[model samples]
Target chain A: MSIMRLLLVEDNARLASLIREGLDRQGFAVDWCESVAGAEHALKINAYDLMLLDLGLPDGEGLDLVRKLRRAKLMLPILILTARGGLDDRVLGLDAGADDYLIKPFQIPELAARCRALLRRPGASLGTTLIVGNISLDTAERTVMVGGHTIEATPREVSLLERLLRRAGHVVAKPALEGALYSMDAEVTPNALEACMSRLRKRLNAAAADVQIRTVHGVGYALFAPVSTDG
Target chain B: MDKAGNRKTGPTGPTLFRQIALRLSGFTLLFAAMDVAIVVVTYSSQPESLAQELLSLEAERVQSATDTDPDYLAGPPGADRWSARYIDDLGEIAGASVGSANGGRLMDWTRRERIAGGYRITGVRSVVRHGKQHWLLMQFEGDGIRPYAPVILDEIVQHVAVPLIPLSTLLLIFNIVAVRRVLKPLRQAEAEVDALDPDNGFHRLSEVTEPREVNTLVRAVNRALMRLDEAMAMLRSFTANAAHELRTPLSIMQLSLDRLPPGEVRDELQADTQHMTRLVEQMLDLAQADALAPELLEQVDLADIGREVVAAMAPKAFADHRDLQFACHGNTIVLGHAEAITRIYRNLIDNALKHAPGQTAIDVIAGPGPQLSVRDHGAGIADEDLPRLFDRFWRKDRRKTDGAGLGLGIVQKLAQVHGGTAMVENAADGGAVFRVTFLAAEPAKPA
Candidate 1:
């Protein structure tokens, strides 16, 4: 069977190489591009299960590229990697067609998890159910089962968790998580979304022994992988 | 001169542009005065000479007419004062005004009780023996005639001089208009340069087509903007990536320390963790402040933010042995972002608590004429330190304080960011009062 294809577009050579190597260790076949031009050519030549885009590309503007990619009918899940603190820019990036955004200087494990989650999205050539230990989530039906014990979640929670479980080792910001909680049109306050996060953190508490949710303080929250060695 | 010199550095007021224009206009007025002086000098010297020439011509004509026929020079029958001599004799005589030297007279027959026409006739009587006959001959000057030429000359001068006033007035107007038109591009370039957002890292100076001298200047500015945008973009990504990557190590460090279970080692570790947390928070705050778009102009309530900050700090104030109080009078509407406004107040309150003598109270009063003053009753600043108080990373006694000394600098930047101003003064009651004034939004009127 063909392994998952991940496209990591980061301008920093060292960081990109480190990420590619780590994702390779996690069973992902990784290809790295440093700029928008390289990324474009790479995307054209080979199909990617997921495209990890850094907003600060050297050649052309990353946002413009994301817009271009979407305009070209490329439905590959794009995860925007950015370091900006402003909600406005994040909103603009997501609105421009990024499925999710991870702030810069991300943990490699979380990057891999987000990559897998994106690859596991419905449009992925390889249709796979997300199985976190015994709990399995069906992307098609958007259903969840834990040891045959089914629990109903709000549509928003399902969407939010899908993104979290997909990038289980990384901390996600409240705003980006909030974007997943609602569709492109809905208005969710930082506080209201905080309330939902409270609910999700509590539910995940039962499985806290295997999985951990950590807060980055003033930033957003993050979900850690089971084998998160350092965290 | 100053603005022209600083033009390379940045934007300036109309002071220098006006200075040059004023000097040019002074030259114009000087030129006008010189033109008037020339007319007066030419008129004073030439009119007498011109009158003598007119007398000679009249004498020659009368002598010739007397020699040809004596009756020709005499007056016609029934001729009155107003009738032209040319109408009576038709060719031999012309009655007009006399010259100024001849008492400013006009024409009349026999020169009796001369009424002014266009000239005056002056009389000179001479007796001479011609071939044994003593003849009494009256030599008369056509008084009206001399004044006639210069009057036409004066009329020509008047016509020319009259239009020049309006023309120069028009020229003055035209000068002002022309200056304004030419300076338009320069002014536009200045405005665009002024509007460049250092925070956004996105400034497009489309006004590159300036005067040849400044075209390169605009190009240089755009280049600088390009460099800034690239650097900022890189910084943004680097910060984000670094923040994310460090989290695992940071959490692992915390988790490893957390598992040590509340002992000396753990306490030390926790303190270190908190310190790290503060560092992270600072980095994030600095990154945020850097990324803040200067274009976020809004009518924010400083008083409301003040109250909120004070209320939020109530617990911290009690712990620090200080009082955080708010004295807001009314809705203080100033144009700024809500977040920045809140941050400004928070920094001010934090600074007061951090610097004030222990057990002293800090009172913040907002909502007074677009100005928010923060007063602390404690050891006030020395006059020496007042000027440099707002400089970044500047602290008079860092050992005595528990901050990075960025609070006041942040406040100052906040003041500038909101199109406001800040002033420092020691209040009479032995305290340092920092007043931040965010000018109220101008009320828009109907067109």
Candidate 2:
């Protein structure tokens, strides 16, 4: 797959460089701009997959830039990174047409995970092949593989695996997983989703996948790749 | 200053209506007394004039009686005390002196003299009765011929005191109405002052329509409020700028630490950075809660906020090996600032997570009074620690210093800002329940 391109609009030079380096390690090609004008000029010339914006820009507010891009009919997903951690600020950022908001002083891995979550939306630019650790699901082919070996799984388990693989490192809420697994009008039993999740967990375990499914009781489930002990 | 002085004198001090009413009643009494004095003086000094008036009235009756019947001898019906006699000449009464004649009357003269027991006033008039010239004489006698003090008092009571009752009542009614009319603007100004919220800098007592004296005070108060508003605004902006300045560097440090190789040193630094981040976030939250204004409040669903907070904090609770659960009963709508309400729930849950033992579930419940409560199955707070739990920078144990102790303070302040309250108590079985209640609001109707 081609490397996904990202535009990083941030004023702080060191922070911007560090973020770019971190995103580069996550297999993203990041183009950095220090001001709204520079960002606008870059957007005019580049076909980027997504934009990472900082609210406090030198020339203009990042919210205004998002609004301008949305008004101009640019459909690329924009994630706001801001030092303003107030709840009102987050609401305002999303209300002004940004897809997601992340408060500052955040971990790079979390940031990358959020970016991937945004890209994994139905119409987003992310490819059909979803990979988390040794497990990968090819959406176009409707198949699941562990360590390059195909696994026998029901269509329901495959769909559940795909949903989990899309948000691999983050907790996908129970209601959200249920919504993704069933049609809106379907009459689902109380334990149907839980039963499916258990079956899928067993299947992954039997196949010796490197990934692990962790259930956060009363909250949701998260998939994590076990840490490699070897250097 | 005057208002403060008035307040210092206590609530029983005179009001404007009382002061005006007292002065009016005083003037009414004074005028009533003066009227009585005048009546008494005039009645005492003019006794002779009164007697002369009675004697003349008697003389007319005698003349009319002689004309009707020449042998009439009985005194006029009600004037038996007056004596009447027919004489051919005025020389009959010795020591009789000629008195003043009545103006515009023929053969009418009055004479007054001291008798044995009293003074006598005699009025004589010449009348041609039965075609013969005869003089008709009438005399009135009384001790000193002066009105008694009690009689004068009776007259004054009848004429002055009786009428003055309704007159003074009318005057009092007029006084109350007039005073209320004059103080109406002041009462309205008082209401405006009462409605003024200290956190809302834009609210001011109206200066227009107030009386001149009260307008001066209102203007002074408005000026003070304006200055206060400016100072508060400066303080809030300073806090906001401080937050920005502090968090930017913290973000940089966190990112830098995130880029480091996986090791114990990096993990320790990351934990320290996380602690600092929590501290900064709590401090900023406290500042924001402090600056929350009444105008920013709106109808918000406590259930929605509770669910969101619990969902967001569940992962953290999971990391600590605790389960976070949320349950909402009926409609949990309340008048509040949405963001502030969210913070309140987050803070309570955070506190519960920190205090509750590992592997226990923390339950967040919203409902009933539109109240949000967080309960954890851990050893309850000590009795002595409950009172100081919400105080800023007051922690139960100083040795276990993971928090800066500002979270509960922020929670309490935000709750109060939304016209709500925060309280903590030990549950009957075990664990501590921290509850915050907001003023309930009616649910919105569908369009």
Error of 2 at B181 (Å): 3.5
User: For model 2, what is the alpha-carbon lDDT of residue B329?
Assistant: 77
- lDDT score of residue B399 within candidate 1: 69
Residue A100 alpha-carbon offset, candidate 2, angstroms: 1.7
lDDT per residue (tens digit) for residues B1-447 in model 2: 155754434568899889988998899889899998887677668765545545555555566665454325544333325666677777876665544433323436666667777666676776666787667776655564242334455567777889998899998999889889878877787778767665555588777654677778779888988898898888877876687678879988988997789999999998889898888888788778887776677888887777667767765676666777877776688998888888888888888888888788888899866788999899999999999999999888878758999999998888887788999999999999999988888668787
lDDT, residue A59, model 1? 82
Question: Number of the top candidate by TM-score?
Answer: 2
Q: How far off is residue A31 in model 2, in Å?
A: 3.4
Error at B255, model 1, angstroms: 5.1
- DockQ scores of all models, one per candidate: 0.04, 0.42
Candidate 1 lDDT, B62-131, residue by residue in tens: 4446444433553321222211121212123345332322312211222323445433333221212233
What TM-score, computed on C-alpha atoms, does each candidate reach?
0.40, 0.74
For model 2, how does the per-residue alpha-carbon lDDT over A69-118 read when each residue is reduced to its tens digit? Answer: 99999999999998887748988998999999988878777888788778
TM-score of chain B of 1: 0.52
